[model samples]
Target chain A: MSRPTRTTEESIARVLPELDYSKIALSLVVMLFFAFFVSPIWTGLVTAFKTTGAVTATTPFVPVLPGTEGFTLAKWTRAIGYLSTGFVNSLAMTIPATIVSVFLGSTAAYGLTLVDWNERLQFGILILFIAGIFIPYQAVLVPLSDFWINLVPLVDILAPVWQLPFLEPDHARLLSLTITHVVYGIPLCMLLFRSYYLTLSDELVEAAKIDGATISRIYRRIILPLSKPMIGVVFIYQFTAIWNEFLFSLTLIGSSSSPAATVTLVLSGMGVDLSGIDFGFRMAGAFVAAMPTLIIYVLFAEQFARGLAEGNT
Target chain B: MAGSQDTATGSRTIGGGETDWRTRVETFSKSDFVRSFPYWFVPFSLVGMGVYGGIGWNTVISLTDYEGFDRPDYTNLDFSMYAQALSDPWVYLTAKNTLVLLIAFTTITLVLGLLLSILLDRGIRYKEKIQTIYLLPMALSFVVTAQFWLWMYNVNNGLVNAVVGVFGLGPFNWIGNPDLVLGAVIFALIWQYSGYAMVVFLAGLQAIPDDQFEAAHIDGAGVFKTYWRVIIPQLKSSSVSAAVVLMVFALKAFTFLYAMFGQYRVPKATDILATLMVREAFMLQHWAYAAAIGTILLVMALAVVAPYLWYQYGQGSL
Candidate 1:
């Protein structure tokens, strides 16, 4: 028994939708944009693995896989060796600064919501926190430096009288840098936490209040537990920011001999050579310095994107 | 005084002229200010002192001729620094550079980001993966991006020159040539932040209902026409928010440039008010002059922020 042959329209119908010219064009454009976006980092990564000679001699687009002079661990070792102290210092500052900022900011955001003050006073306080976001770091650069320097005198005067340990002015620079980062981070942290908290139902807060929970008690018991996602978002957000901060670190800490130098300062301190930059070493160091944020992005991309999107909105 | 205090307490007796003293105390304790004061105190004080107080102090320094000193001398207060900054050719050049960067970088990033977002929103496959690929750069630090771009923009063996060379374009000394430095830096910045703008625009695009597209199609509108007329207009808020953030970052590009060159002294071509401020204060010890420049930067930042705040207020979201 012979089967009827399919007509042109039937055959066409049997086939799945072919992407039209516009769709094909769109896919190409999208691919190109993504390619452009990914190229620099990919090049950096490839260069990081390459030997110095290969870095200068080879085409940048080629991945430096195993074999040839394309691959070497020398750059990574050297870069890490040079930047170890900087990594330590950055972590030392960023972890504490992130914690402090998140704590203060979350509390402040919670307070803003729970407070029963007059509308103007409440808005005024909220606005003050928001306004911090717009204050250029340059505005605070000179004054903050002076403030830290002069703080030593105040500390000296108080140490003997209050039986406190005295600190040298220069030694306090690291502390000042941490404080600056913490303070600067608060506005953003508070904004994120506040917006997130605003979305949560007030029933929990109301119930806590009715149950005679103190403000701190409410925050610790009800809000804090409920705020895990937001805390993660804020923590990562602030961590990434405080980790990458340069101006405050450079200005406040300068190029101190101690391990107080941040990763950014240390990486940046790897000044471009006049003859030729060791592209391999630079790329390796760049990759290492970027690892933490990159890890955060890879692992918690949703939270990161949400946090940033929330901040803008 | 003791008797009056006793009466004040007694006036709060059960069903009396007022509630009991205990009730009044309870009210006081329950007051929002008292209840929430501890929570608000630390952040408010720190931010107030660190930010607003710093601005005030900077203004004071700008009014005096404080230079090459640990402490700013407030003895002879005047606006000489401001006058000098206004008249200096360097300041004028820096200001112009700042404006150019602010306008050019923002407009380009926004347009690029909008295009990317629209493409992604139009039923792209592997949407999440593709979106993340575009967004990966935003998570990188300025130090990293600067370092990466330096190598990429190298005249020899750099990916940029190599890619362009294929199209028969000559190798461009992207960083060495003063004329190209600003553009190069701006391009790097766009690479880092256009993802940010895209994410914002994408969110705006997603919020728009699918019916809008269907309706536009029914009306015989092309995809481009639908996006231009029906979709882009709805992104006004997103565009504003993204623009404000981008512009502010542009003002703060001092750090990026400083990191790129590994010094306070960046190439003159890329000198914005921010880099100029840092270099003058830290490098040249022109404390008062830098302060004046800082004040101007603060004003520019405020100019960008004021409208956003006003918009939020209008939306009753403040």
Candidate 2:
């Protein structure tokens, strides 16, 4: 009944084994590396909260001084005010682009996976899509610019529609940006979805097929529902990529004016235009520009990690 | 199949061939190829036109001396742009820098990531929280990271210098010095992406069976020895995949440099083929020259990715 009168020291020893020097060393090393890894972000956080005077006066890693208007949301407000237009433009561009690309790419992946085609042909088609993922955007930049310029006339055909009350003038540029992102995004999205779709059991598709379900119907009823987790993964990955995209935005939309610029473009401009704005203000803008993706990462870290792991390998 | 064929022929004769044509049309429409056409063909064609067509057009432009605001002269074309690129010293320098960046960045990040992953795998507590902290940087845009590092590398009050100063080192111009610029850029990039490498390697590490570690331990191998011998060799595939991705990212690091300097003309010390290509085209309007450079960059990227694609293809994963 007394469990052989087990001693406290025996139980303690059972729970916590003898100390290992290597384990302790490993932990210490990891802790040090963590500090290095987080130092920039820590610095950014501190600097973003400091007053303009305190930012330059104090070390970057330190918090604001006691007497110097300790912490202010002024920088954040000012930064957001400057970036608000670009922020909206980015949302306008990123949202539709992500949805369209994901939808189309997923459908394409579904087709590739389930369609009865010649094996060589299917493999060939997949290689074609996979090749697109590796093509440096620089290779296509010149022609893409030319293509967009040529497309302006076609876009202008919608001028009457663009003149509607809710549409802004910058919507045209955003539309162009959206189209660019969608087209470029398709390959990646298709690759990711196709890989995920490949893992799904063939019996699920075959069972639906035997029940007189058309491919599209089966996709809508069964595949799409089953693909929710994958959709989430691809969505977060593409959203972050498209949101943080700079070259396409810079090359396609340019930093010409406020209304049409993406958040990355505007943030780059802020960094460049070192005029009256303080370091805190600029850092705040950078943080603001990065917020959506950061938030997505924080909330969907598992999906983000899954996406990275699956997408790469 | 026999019944359908019989019906097809019987209807062909009896219905004046009209019903047969309709039935044939219905049969063809129901074929797998036709049924799945919308799902695959539409997106495939779009990518084809956008990416392949763009590359084709860029190559055409590069063949011609297309500069300034004028339309590219398509009728007359030559290899003169490639010739010029080959002859230019700046091209050589930038190409060297690109190669250096590609190799150095990939190797170092992989090593650091490997180290981190190994440490992380060793029964660390709060593993998820620790990994998330390390990975948070990867979630940020290069624009944000560049800003953070710019401040970190600032000559006077920068965190890097501040820490170094504590060790009796003088404030150094990390961004300005030619010798330090590339290394500084590489360090910043490593800071951002080593976490990615770690995550990739961690997945690799976890996939190794625990029995392997137990076997190694039973064989009197130390922890370091077990990882070095029994564990790391199995991670070759992981390393290959990670290297391919990291190399691709290293090529695309034009965004980071662009954000850091906020200009096409970055510090000469850190100027890569990407920045140089953009500057030549957009700034100098050397469209043909830039197109040539872009083509070269594309070839370089393909060189890096081709083996990976082939491996995936060989594995029937494609």
lDDT for each candidate structure = 0.82, 0.83
Quote the lDDT for A71 in model 2.
78
lDDT of 2 by residue, A168-266 (tens): 655676788899899999988988898788888889887777677787888899989998989999999999989999888888776636478988898
Encode model 1's per-residue lDDT on B1-318: one tens digit a residue.
Answer: 233345555665545533665556656666667768889888999899989999999999999888886677899999888888888999889989999999999999999999888777766678888888998988888988888898888988888899889899969999999999999999899899998899899888878876666676667665566678888999998999899999998887877898788788889999899999988888888888889999999999999999899998898777
TM-scores of the models, in the given order?
0.91, 0.93
Q: RMSD of each candidate?
A: 5.9, 4.4
Best by lDDT: 2
Q: What share of the true interface contacts does each candidate keep?
A: 0.69, 0.65
Residue B250: error of model 2 in Å?
Answer: 1.5
C-alpha lDDT of residue B58 in model 2: 93
Across B1-318, the per-residue lDDT of candidate 2 in tens digits comes to: 333455577676777667867888767777667778899998999999999999999999999999998778898899999999999999889888888998999999999999988777765778888888888888898988998998898887789999999999968999889999899999999999898999999888778776676576567665566677888999988899899999988876798998888788998878889899888888888999999999999899999899898897687655
**Candidate 1 lDDT over residue span A50-85, tens digit each:** 887788778886887787656898899998988888
